[model samples]
Every structure is written in structure tokens, then in C-alpha cells.
Target: MARTRPTKRQLEGLLVTALYGATWWGILSSRTPFNWVLTVASGITAECVRHSSGRDRLDCLGDAFGAIGGISGDVETGIRPYTNGIAQTKTQIISHALKQLPMGESLQQRFLDRQGVNTDWFEGFEKRCAVLVGESKDGKTFLLKWRLQRFIEQHPDGHEYYIGDIDYGRCHEGDTPNTWFDSPVGQAVFTTADDIAAKVRAIAQDIRDGHDAAVPTLIILDELVDTMEDMDRDQFEQFMRDLKTIKNRGLKAGNITFVLGLHSTTVGETGIPQWLLRGVETIWLYRAGQERANFLHLNGKNIDECPKQLARLPRSFNGLRPCIVYSDKKLSVKAIPTLDFGNIEVKYSTVELSAIQQWEQDHWTPEKELTVLQKMREREASGKTPYSNRDIMPIIGIRQNQCVRSNEVYEHAKSLILALWESSKKSEG
Candidate 1:
């Protein structure tokens, strides 16, 4: 004869004990490595047999057996290996999935298939804020840039990008304040945090109202606080407060992710309020000093084994090679090489030299062409390059001083213009 099943109360009681008590039920359900069908089936069977197994009533032997089977399957499939003290609750699992889903369709689909999270599930999700403490000029910018590119490439759907770098130069001129990111006009604008916060609020509004037309926004602030030497404590506090306000209010409106970058010491050194620190979820520490060591904690533990590679980083490598640093979770120090600007891809049409003749053909009338030639002649007589910063800055909003700071910037800009000019001449031919 087939065995009889237990009542719902008996089953619940057994399952609860098997899962190490009610507090752990959420983790058991969500983090179980066993296939969902198998997990549910096994759980049901354990419930039916728990009381009849003749095991200690408090032991819940049947449910324990089921949990063992589920955990075995989970391990084979490479699920969470160790629970440690951290709560692997269902809520946390779902929260982590959503945060990382912006990376690609595969991830999004994985989360969608779970069928556990409700439509309003993410409403209460709040991850811990992080403090990325790193040494000065230790490829922090490059790492931040890489993560950003990865996020953008993975999420083809519209995402907002806000970058704040304190090192504002003459090259960044004539940019508008708080523009939507999808258009050329918006892309043309170089922004500060103040500009980004306002834009984030607007995008968030569109998302909250179920305005299907709105796109997600990714705001990246490079060197988050500007002019460190000039900004005072109160002023810095206010700036951070404004950003916190924007973040708190914007979450309801749309998908807004902020990737803020700053030297590890800026906030502490400048006497900025620590209240801003509470708003960050994950702190990606690049290279930090001893004083700021306490701020960086990994997997809920203080990182005692800091990487020595960060000790002495050279700013400029052999004209070609990029400076690199390691910061992977497993290795504690994953190598991140510099990007090769020469090999970087450009999707939109760039101003190429070959296009010069096309420009002359399409836009420059014979009279205009002749007039330009005359002007070039006059410039040659004056010992000036007809193509100087004066001629280009107005069009690109890049200043001469900023471009000239490093030979790399100057050469790149110069090469583009030269390429365009040559291309135009060839087209004219």
C-alpha cells in the first residue's frame, strides 16, 4: 500500500525545521540549486513522510533528507557554495538578479523565468552603500570607464549616462545644462553632477508615470566632486545632499543607475559630510591609503589582504601600453589594462579627412571655396596654420589649452583634422 501524506501543518512544521527554522525558509526556496520542479516535488514528499519516518519530532528527518537532495543538486550546478553568516534570503536573491539584469537579455530572461518576484517586488530592495577607497591615479578612471562601457554595451535599451569629473578643462566648453541623453544635442553637452541630478529626476518621472516612451538613464560622475581645492565642507555637503535627494525620489520614476567616480580621499580630505556615503550600494575600491582602510569591506568582511600592486603605479607607460591594475573578486587584484584609443570603435559618422571633399562638394559653393582658399593663403602669409584651435574650438567646444596639456590629446585632434582635410582634397580630385 502507498504511504499516506501528512497534513499541511505537519508538512509546514517539518519543512521549517529541515530548512534550519523559519528564518531560513526564504533562502531555501530561492537559493535551492535543485530544479524548481524537483525542489517542489521533493519538498511535498518530505512533508508527507516527516511524521511517519519515526525520526525525532524536532529533527524533521524527512524534510532534512529533501533539503540534502536539493542542496546536492544545487552544488552540482554551481550554486552558492557557502552561506556564511549572510542572509541568502529570497528577497536578496531577487534583488541581486534585478540589479545585474541590466547587463543583457540572457540575464533579464533568467530573472523573468523565476516567476517568484511580483510586479511590485523591487519596491523594497535596498542594497548597502559602498565606499571605493583607492590610491591616487591608480587606473580608477579606467576601471570605472570599463564597467560603464560594459553596462552600456549590454543594455542596448536606452540608459542614461551622467559623468562628473572635477578636472574640467578648457576643452569642455559651451555644453548645455541638463539635457536628455538620446539626442545629439544632449550628447554634445559635457556635464557636472548638478546638471545630471536634474536630468535624472526628469527621466525618473517619465518611468514612474508608465510613459512607455521613456528610456533608462545611467549617470557616471568622474571625479564626483569638482575643484577639490576650492570647494568647502558646507558646499560639498549640500551637493551630496542634492544628489541623495535626487536618487531617493528618482527610483520610483525609472531605471536610474549612478556610477560615481572620485579620488578615495576627496570626500574625507575636503571635509565633506559622511551622510552622502550612506547612499552608495557597492564600493569598488581601487587603491586606498591606510587611514581610509576601514571604509572598504568585502563580502561583509574587512579586506585584510590588500593588493601590493597598487604601491607604485606609473602614470604614463611606454607611449603605447596602458597602465593596468587588478580588482577581481576572486583574485582580490584583477588586471585592468588601459584602452587603446587607436583601436576604439566609433559607431556614428566621424569627421574623416576623406569626407573633406564631400563637404566641399555638398556645402561649399564655388564662391565659398574660393573665399576659403583666399583665407588659407592669408593664413599662410601670416605664418599661421589655417587649421588652428581658433578655427576648430568653436565647432567642437574643445579648448586649445586643454587639448595641448598632453601630447596625446593634441596629436589625436590634429590627426582628425588632417584626415578630414586630406579626405576632402581627395574627394575634390
Candidate 2:
């Protein structure tokens, strides 16, 4: 087959002109200039039409002219807009990718008996909030705080936390209005029910809009008694109802949980309404010493055995013996052991505490104190003792004793030393 090529004159002339015009358009529009080889190679171009006042006809040679014109328009109108869109899209993709990544480590497997109970009790209950009411100093706050923390940690990508508390000492000085918007915990605020509905919506909107991360947020109403105490029964009922509304709305839209803590005198008083009780799923009762029975009653248990089972809990039970009751149609009781805060050398377990009580024939006596002191003096006399008074005090659980502050452990140790000295002197005589 025969083929024809453009003459060198035509190639060098029209193409050269087209290339120059295209290069001019590219340089004017670009942040970085066009390549030199492309400019030289594409120089030839068409000038097929004349601008005249007449009906236009398609030029037989308009393709080359149109191609040259298209290059200039694309440089001006298309490149920058397309590039910006791509950059924004990449940012969104990266953000979403980061969200899917898991936290560095999974939590250790510790059995939370009470949480398990609450899980079982609230199995079928929907549209509910738990009302924990009991004697002060019970582990209500401890358990509630722990569970809330665990829930948030588990659902890291659910919604951002929007915690609102009162303006107590905990709220910090210089905390201003809308200060929550600046909080890394995610737009938290300290406010009352007066404008809570609006503030909650605003915080929730920010989360939904993707401006904030969609992590499951906890709204803790600390000392709820302070706010709801003065309110009449109807008013209290209305407040509880409003919370239920927030719960339903917030949960459906994203992950939002509300936790409130109060004393029994407040939530159990005449100001509260009965209808509001239906909204709560789990009720935790915390009581210290002799109030365990009262706590049981609030959780829906009846006291059966009288004085025998009503014995006072040990003084060391301040942080011990975490028991739980589940709120189903009725409350079920479970007795769990206490946690021992001790060194490995003197680690006391619930079983060990009971054993020690049985061995002493009375529980946690100071009589063993005198005996232990005698042994320490013997060790010191023989120069076999390596540990000091500092080492000995904690072993007996008397170092940080709030009731008996040990400023001079040596004074206490001196008495034990004197007892041994007197006994040794008498034996020699």
C-alpha cells in the first residue's frame, strides 16, 4: 500500500505555529511550565475559520483547530478544579481508614460479676435508664464509672463523648461558656437541664456531620441529687422522661449513653415519681457496714434471716467485698469476694481473710501485733534483721492507717523493743 506524509515545509510551518500557541496557553495557566519537547513537537496547527457576521459552516479542517482550542480551555478550567476534588476525596478516605484501625491493645480478661448480672437482668428491657440508689460509700460510683469507661473504650469509633457535669471543684477554674467545644474528649460542657436539650443536639450534630469522631460518648450527670432534689414529684418525673427521650433519640442516631449518680436520700425521697422508675433497666445499691440489708431491699430483695446474717462488715471492708444485685422483674443477689490491696509477700485473699479470722478465733486483731514485734526484736538483737520499720508497718497494714497515722514508726517499734528488753532483763534476774 502507498502512504503519503506531510512535506517538511508544511510540517515545519503549521505544526510549529500550533505548538507555540499551545505552549503559551500551558505556561500562562500552569504552576509548573509545560515540557520543552512537547512544545517543539506539537508546533504545527490549523487556522480553519474566520470570525465573520454570517451563518457558520463546519470546517473540513476544524479538528486540528478544535484540538488546539481544547488544550487552552482544559488548562484554564479543568485541571485545578479536578485536582482539588481529588485531594479532598483522598483526605476523607484516609480519615475513614484511620477510624477502622483498632486500639493498640485489647483489655485484659477480668470477670466483672455485677456487669454480667446487669447484662442478664436487662435482657429484654428497652427504653430504660438505670437508677442506682443506696447508702453513701457503697461501690456504686466505682462500679458505674468503671462500666461506663469500659463501654466507651470498647466502642472507640461509635461517637465522641459529650460529658456534662455541674460547676463543682472538679469542673476547674477559668472554664468558660462553650469550653466543651474545645475539649479533646469531644465537645463536653458543664450545664443544667435548662438548656441541655439544645446543647445535646448541637454536640450530636457536630458528631453526625463528621467534624467530630463518631465514638460512643458518655454523659455523666454527677450528683444528680443537687439538680433534681428540689423539684416536686411531677417535675422529677418530667426530668426522667426527658432523659428517656434523649436516650432513644441519641442511640438511634449514633452511640450515646447517659449515666447519673445520686445518693439514696435524693432518688428515694418523696420528690421522685413512681412512673419514672419504669424507665430504668438496672439499679445498683451500695451500702456500707450495717446498711447492706437496706441496699438489698432497694434492689427488690426481702430481709429473711434477722440478727445472725445482719452482722456488721469488717472495717477493712471499706474497699472489700463487692456484691451485686440485678434488677429484673425482681432482684437476685450474688456474693463476690473482696479485692486485696497488698504486696505479693502479704497478699490476702477473701479465703485467706476468713482463714486468718478462724485461726485467731477473732477477726483482724492487734494482739498479733505484739507477737510480731517480739519476733522483730529477736531478729534485731541477733543482727539478723535486714528490713526497717518502714518495711514492717505495711506488712501489718498499719502504715497508711487513717485512724492511727504513723509519723514515728520507730516509736511504735521502740515499745516492742522495750517489751523484749524488759522480758530479757527479767529472765536474767
Candidate 3:
């Protein structure tokens, strides 16, 4: 297409030069339809020539002369192909962006199936969320670690682990090999239930709204009872809502997978509802005992042999234990292996409650800041003070340069968040 149209003075000069001694009044004297058409066509041709480049401008001059003389056999070729090429290029870009985003069927699964990774361990789903439910000493942690190790090993493109509730006396706390700390992302060791919920909520939103490729992150949240122990009924409902949204929608992004561990599958015991559990694609039932019946019902199965197998399962602190695997309406008993983290030994430092870690800095937006401030406000209303500087920094997305001194974190954020809230309220009013 033409880069720039000519100015009024330039066009006037061009018309004068092209028409020789003929002026605007001279053309208007004809006052015929054919003359009016010629006038408009002549102006268009002149502008095209003025803005066009190289050989195209030279070819446009013949068309310009032809328009002035009212010739019938004039050819105007270059601009048509130029404009068409631009349109085609734009169409190609749009088509490429919409390739992964489908209108009818899901293209995410197709692309993942094309990747041809291992789903043998996953039961039914490809890389979606899974849950491990069993007694405390029933090797839930070890099996999850093994599955996660396999997930990381299978995806040669790399993966990360963000752990919540790394219990002090849990199986592999000191043994670093194949554990959550093996590839622990920056400050991702979540100590409190609140921090865990907040991070998961933020990540779910990112996966829902983002178009860029995310790193395949396996968020292993252990012991739901402990995680949601402090949340009241309303907060628990919101947390469940967030969890359900992510469980159903987060997996298709080809990243953002979860391996949540539950001590009991009963809704009353774990505070997790049947609706949420029914939606999970993969479930590992290890020594779940009475919870196995509820699990069986959720999967639309009533097999007698499943219970017999569950009853006969070994009950002791041993190696790998037999467990029931339910997925896609298929139920089978399989032995879950205990992961050996080898001779490598490392112990975690003392963990304090509500010690905030770094949230994703790049994805923090104005809307997210609003959410953070609201959370802070809730704590303030409850008479809960900010625990540490680390808590405020990650939640509010505060950079180091923003602070004048190290000692002003809690007080500064308290005053600032309240002020921002007031200002926002005024603006809305």
C-alpha cells in the first residue's frame, strides 16, 4: 500500500503540473457526469503516484495520464497485488494465533497426544491433576514423589516443583533426592495454608488468562486438612471454588499440573467435597479404608473385588504397598512403589507460619494488587499483623528500590495499603 498521501499544496501543485494550464474552474464548466468521474479518478491516481515507491510509482504515472485524458485501456496493476499481499499476511498471523484456541473441539489434547509422553502412570488424564489418598504411614508421600520424579524425567523440556506442607516428620524430609526440594522453585516452600491457597489461586488465573507458554510446574500440596485448617466456611468455599476452576480448566494449557495429597477422601474429614473429587482425572487410593467406598461410588463403579483387594492390602510400615487406581471408569489394584532418595541427605530449616514467598512478579497487574490489598485488609480486620517483611514483599509485588529502609516493611505496607484502599474508594465514588 501507499506509505503517505500528498499534502494539499503538494496535490495542488501536482494537479497543476499534470493538467498543464487547466484549472479546477475549467473542469467544472463541463458539469457532466463523465467529467465528474474523471475529476475524482484523476485525483485518486495522482495521490497513488505521489505515495507509491520505486517502479510502482513509475507505472502509476501512466494510469494518472490515462485518467486525465479519459482513456479506456489504462492499466493499474501494482497496487492491487500489494494490498492483497498485506491482507493475506495479516490473515496468516491471526490464523496462527487461533490454531491452539479451538472453536469446537479441544486442540490442547491433540497437541499433547502428539507429544506422546507417558500416561501409563497417570491412569486416564495426560498431564492433568491427580490425587493420592491414604493413611499417614501408607506411603502416599513416597508414591507421589516417584510419580513426580517420573513426570520430570519424562518431560525432557524440564519441570519444577512447588511444595506445600512439607511436614517435619514426613517420609523424606531430610533426604533431598527425588523430593520437592530437588527442583524447588525460588521461595516456593509454602508453610501456611493461606499462602498455599493464595499462590494456587494466582497460578490458576495466570493459566486461564495467559497466552505465553508456562513452565510445566507440578504443585504438590500435601494434607488438605492442614492446608485449609484455618479457613472458615466462607473462605473454604472460595478456596474450593478456586481449586475446582483450576482442576477443570488449568490442565489444557500444557503446563500447570497438580498432585494434591489427602489423608482421607471423606468430605467431612478432608473438607473436600464429592463434586471436586469427581472431576479429578487420576486418583490413587492407598489404604483409604472406608473412604474407598465413597471413591468407588464417585467413579461410577460398584465392583465387589475392589473391596476384597482393599481389605487384603498389607497394613504396616513397609516398602511399596498395593493400592486401587481409579480413572476414566476403570478400577484396578496396583502396587505403588516407594521412592528411594538415595544416600543424599539434607534437612530443611525451621519453618514459620505465613512467611510469604515471591509471587510471579511479571504477571502482577492492577487487578491483582487490588486482591492483595483486600487480603491484607482482611488480616487487619481480624487483628492479625503482618508476620514478616517477606510476607508483604511477595503479596504486594514490592521491589527493593520502592522501600526507603529495611525496617519500614510492616508499618509502611499497613499505612500504604489502607491509603490505596481509601483512594480507590474515592475514585470509584
Candidate 4:
């Protein structure tokens, strides 16, 4: 006869019984010298059983032990858990993440105040059009994501649209594009190259007619060159034309900003149109070859400062290369540290939570989970906070109060964050 399977209730009872037995043994054995060892062994055993069975009930038990072990570790180190995930109105994601990173100066203040520019310079817009180019693993996408998140946080009232092959396949997959277009945020997000071009043209016409709203609109195009590669020449040219028109009219009124991210090879091999390159007022150069460096006129004297800047670029401990930001008036090289969201639990709005659940349902699989776990371990080894699907799920409001590992870092980091905020105010004053 085949073995009988346990019911869900039976499994739950077994898990509770095992945990209670472990706790009792740990407590009773505390009088002995090997008490700590026994306690630790019990936790390890729980985890082993979780993996051994591959059953949901055992997995829950393992997670419970993991949470307990994690909390115990945090308490042992005196590191207070920073669970402030309630999204703040003013770039809270960046600000909260910054608290966990060690930076010479706050990035939020530097971008907003210093850099020899002011918000008024862009008129009502936060910034102008910029192209981010880098070699693979050089952190172009990371920087773009950071900038985009900051923009969304800063301009809550503004419409935000993103087209990319990142986590979401909204624009990359055929059906997702239609799904996105049907969503509440669809009005702002474009699903195709043609759609984006058309939207830009319409916005430009509205700006020309002086009928555009005062609120800013930010659009991020990731891997633009690659995206254009899939489009016909006419479509590409039309998109470029629309971009140029938008850059001239939309930028001055401070009503729109376009952020384009591309690979260095894409610019060299495919050759971005001169008009699009000229429209880029801000350039961020990551690790690229000499040929790639040649495109950047950093000094206006053909001094080849790009190569030198690229050489001096810092390598992040977490395996990301730094980049230099060059503008018309000022140039600065900075490495954006990877911020850990592990300790910071975040809550999302209803719509956002629903989207996250749907995304999880669509993408989550055993193979994917294993891959994510492996990556998380690598990140942890590099002294960075690793964000797993479990961590993100809670932040996006899919789940609640998930215990992401704490770094046990000092609480003083909060003061630095506050100081950065004060600096922004000081600059304004």
C-alpha cells in the first residue's frame, strides 16, 4: 500500500509540536554547558527539515526558525531594526535606502541643490534630458532606476511612465503591453515605440498650444537603441523626430523630461542620431572603452577627459562600477552605493499592491526562486544587503511584516539622512 499523505491541519500540528519540543529541550538544557549549542542545532535542524521535505508546511516551520534566528542576531548586535516602509511623500525610497549606505555627502542634496544648478534652471521641471551610457555590469541600469525612483518620489503629482526590459515585461512582451495600456496608469505609459512617439508628438503640440498642464511628466526609456533596433527605420526616425521636438518645446516649459539609457556598444555600433545626442544636456559615463570615451566631449578641448574619468571610476564592493556625470557647467564623479531594503519594510497603495501580486503570480517559479536566493547570498557575501523576492513582496504590499535579515548597522545612519535633508533646505534658503 502507498503511504498516506498528511492533511493540512495535521501538518500544522506536527510543525507546532516539533517547535514546542525544540523550545522545551532548549530551555531544559540551558542548565547544561552545551545549551547554546543545542539551541543553535535545533534551529539548523528546523531549516534542514524545511529543505528536505519540500513541503509547504515544513517550509513555514523553517521560515519561523529563520525569522527567530535573524531577530536574535539583530538583538545580539544591538542594531535596531529600521522598519519604516511607509512610503514617504519626498523620495522616501532613496532617503530610507541611503540611511543604510555610507556616502561622503548625501546624493539627494547634491542633485537638488549643488552641481551649480537649480530647479529653476530647468524651469518647472526637476532636470533635463540625459543619456546614460555604460558597458555591461557598469551600473547604467542601476543609476537609471535610482534616478527614476527619485523622480517619482519627488513629483508625486506628475505622471510617470517607463518602457524597458527590466523586472516588468510591460513593453517587452506583446500581451503585457495591452495589459499595461488597459491599466489605470496606462494613459501615461506607452506600450510601443510608435505609441511613445505619438504620445510625445501630442504632448509637444499641447505645449505649443500653451494648453499643457503645469505638472511635470517624466518618461524613462531603457535600452533605447536596442528597442529601436526592433523597429523599422521610419519608426526609429519618427521617434527621434518626436524626441527632438519634445526636447525643444517640452523642456523649456518644464513640463517633460526624458531619461534614456543605452549601452556604449549600442551608441558605437548602431550610431545614435546626431539630433538625439545633441539634445542630451546631462551625460553619465560608466565603464566603457576608449572608443566609447571618444564620443564624450567632456572638456570641449578634445582633451579626452572621458578616458581619465573612466579610469578613476570607483569599483563598488558590490560589483558595480561608478560613473561620472557631466553637465554643461559642472562635472562630478560619484559612485551610487547599493542601498539595502532588507530592514526597511514598506507598505504600498492598494493598486500598487494588486499589481505586485499579479506580477508575483506571473513570474514566481521554483527555478526563479532558487536563482534569486543564490544571488542574494552573493550580495550578502559582498557586505551588501541582499533583497530577495520575499523582501520585495512585503515592500510592494504583497505580504506583511516579512523578516528580512538585519545588517545590525548602527542607528547613527539616520542622523546623516536627516542632515542631508537639512542641506537641501539650506541650499534653498
What is the descending lDDT order? 3, 4, 1, 2
Best by TM-score: 3
Each prediction's TM-score versus the true structure: 0.34, 0.36, 0.49, 0.43
Top model number, lDDT: 3
What is the C-alpha lDDT profile of model 3 across 1-429, one tens digit per residue?
111223343344334335421323335464888776676766565565455533332233222322322211111133443343332232122123223232301332232233222225544333567777766445667666665656656565545456776463345333433336344433556766666766676666556556322456677787777778876575677677767766766656646678788776654656677776766654555436424544544544544555433432322112334466666656655544444554332233322322221233233333455576676567667888633344455566565455455535444555555666677568769
**Candidate 4 on 1-429: residue-level lDDT in tens?**
011233453354345436535644675557765876787777676556555666443234323332332233344334323422211111132233333434412432343232222222232123677777765444455556556555656666544444443223433212223222222333444545554554555555456657544566666777677667766675566567667767777756666777777775333565577556654654444444223343554445332544333332222313333445444544444444443222221122222324322333333322333344555557667887665445433322333333333311111222322343355448659
What is the lDDT for 374 in model 1?
Answer: 52
lDDT of model number 4: 0.46
- Using lDDT as the yardstick, the better of models 1 and 2 is 1
Model 1: lDDT to the true structure = 0.39
Model 2, span 1-429: residue lDDT tens? 011233333233324334444655444444533465454334323232222212121221122222322233244344644453432232123123223333201110011221222233432222234555434434445444444444544554443444444533343223233222234322344455433433444444334434332444556565566666544454455456556655555565455557665554223442444444434444434232223333333433333321112121111121233233334544443332333222212111111223322322221223344446566667777887633555454444445442243434434444544564576558769
State the number of backbone clashes in model 1.
29
Error of 2 at 224 (Å): 0.9
In order, what lDDT does every prediction score? 0.39, 0.39, 0.50, 0.46
Tell me how far candidate 1 lies from the true structure as C-alpha RMSD in angstroms.
21.6
User: Which regions in candidate 1 have their CA more than 4 angstroms from the true location?
Assistant: 1-133, 168-213, 227-238, 246-252, 265-268, 282-286, 289-429
For 1-429, candidate 1 gives per-residue lDDT tens digits of 011234444445336444333223433455655545555655565555554555543334223322332333244334433442121231122223334333323432332233121222111211111234333433455445555555456556445455544343322123232222222323423344434443443344334445432344455556554533344454444446545654665444445555555555334453434555544543334334222243443333324332222111111212211111112232122222334323223232212323332332233332333344455447667998766666554343345665674645455545655655566568769
> Among all windows of ten consecutive residues in candidate 2, which has the lowest summed lDDT?
103-112
